[model samples]
Structures are given as C-alpha cells and as structure tokens.
Target: MADLWVGNVDDNTSDDEIREFLIKYGFPSFDEIERYSGTGTRPAVMLIFHDTTPDALRGLQSRIHNMFWKDRTIVVQVMPERDES
Candidate 1:
C-alpha cells in the first residue's frame, strides 16, 4: 500500500474534485482519503492506495507537485511506509 500527501488545496474543493484531478494526472483512483485542515492554514489530504507501492506513487508525484490547481500551488509527496506493528 501507499500513502500520498497533497497540500495547499483549496478549502472549497470537494473530494470528487480531488479524485478527478488525480485521475487527470494519471493517478489511479485512491482507496481512501483523509482530509486535514490544520489551523485552517494549509488544508491537505492524505490519500491511501491499497494496491499501489510507494515507488509507484513517487513516480507519479512529480506530475502534480508544485503545480497550480484551484488557485493554489499544490504540493504532492509520497509518504514513507509506516510500521504497522
């Protein structure tokens, strides 16, 4: 599995909009999404891909990292694997 962190997203953007944006950039549909609005400063979303690998996500990360979307310069990163134990 893989986790992707997408930051600097607009507050008005909906989940479906995010899904579409990622799909438009060649990302497979994510299995889950967790939204974070920390301090209402940098709204972000963590996307979980059940069947994808970190390396695969990393390869696709560059396609959208630092790209302007919804009036914000979004940041995309493939998170490091977490220890399940």
Candidate 2:
C-alpha cells in the first residue's frame, strides 16, 4: 500500500476536484482520497493506493510535486509506512 500526501491544497478545493484532476492527468484509479480540514492557509489531502507498486507511486509523486492546482503549488510525497507493532 502507498499513500501520497498532497499539500498546499486550496481551501476551496473539493474532494471531487482532486479526484477528477488526478484521473484527468493519467493517474490510475486509486482506492481512496481524503481532504483534511483546512485552516485557511494550509490545506492538504491524502491519496491512498493499494494496487500500485512503490516505483509507480514514486513516479506519480514526482509528476505531481510542484504542479499547480487551484492556483496553488502542490507538494506531493510518498508517506512512509507505519510500524504495526
């Protein structure tokens, strides 16, 4: 499993918009996406993918980082795996 953190999302950006943008831009269908509640200045989202490999996830991250969305520069990163102990 891989999760992508998309930062600097606009406060007005909706969940559907993010999903549609990714689909429109050639991203494979994902499992889930969540938009964190914003504090006016800093908003973010997480795109979860369970069907993709690490290399594919990294490629998507590279393609999305520094890209413009809703007029804001988006920062995308592959979230580190968590320990299950």
Candidate 3:
C-alpha cells in the first residue's frame, strides 16, 4: 500500500493554489487534480500520490501538511498508490 494525501482546505483554496503549493514543496504531479462538489464543498482539497512500500508517506503526510499550512491540518490517506509506475 502507498498513499494519497489530500487537503480539504477552506473554500478560498483553489486548484492553482494547491497545485503550486504541492509542487513548490515536494509532492507529486498536479495534473490529476480533481474536484468533489457537494453541498459542503466550501473547503477545497487535493489528491496526492505516494508510492512507498512501507509508507514513508505517513511522516510526509503530517510533515508537509503542518509545514505549509500550520493553521490548517491537511488531510491524508494511505492506500495502494496509483500504478502509474
């Protein structure tokens, strides 16, 4: 299993904003950015892919989240990272 880190950030958050943020720091591609619009879609989020066997992404999850937006807790999920490989 790998990981997919996301951010259900505030509504003001934009795809460009998230994309730039991800790339600027040290995340994967933003080409696959997707949007989920529900009644409560105020806070925007990103879908990141991490492909590490033992999930080195766990540490990255909290670290990246905390590093950039200390105010907001970026959301994360550990799963079978996409088979782009």
What's the count of clashing pairs in each model shown?
Answer: 0, 0, 1
Candidates in order, TM-scores: namely: 0.96, 0.80, 0.52
Model 3 gets an lDDT of 0.55
What tens digits encode model 2's per-residue C-alpha lDDT throughout 15-84? 7788888877777767888888677677888888887765777876767789977788998888886454
Minimal lDDT window, size 10, model 1: 7-16
Pairs of colliding residues, candidate 1: none
Residues 1-85, candidate 3, lDDT per residue (tens digit)?
Answer: 3445465566667767776776666655544445554466435454644334426655555546544363676666545545666
CA lDDT of each prediction against the hidden true structure: 0.93, 0.79, 0.55
- List RMSD in Å for every model shown: 0.7, 1.9, 4.5
**What is the C-alpha local distance difference test score of candidate 2?**
0.79
For model 2, the stretches where C-alpha displacement exceeds 4 angstroms are: none
Best by TM-score: 1
Q: Which stretches in model 1 have alpha-carbon errors above 4 Å?
A: none
Candidate 1 on 1-85: residue-level lDDT in tens? 9999999997889889999999999999999999999889889999999999999998899999999998889999999998889
Q: Quick one: RMSD of model 1?
A: 0.7
Instruction: Report the Cα lDDT for residue 56, model 3.
Output: 60
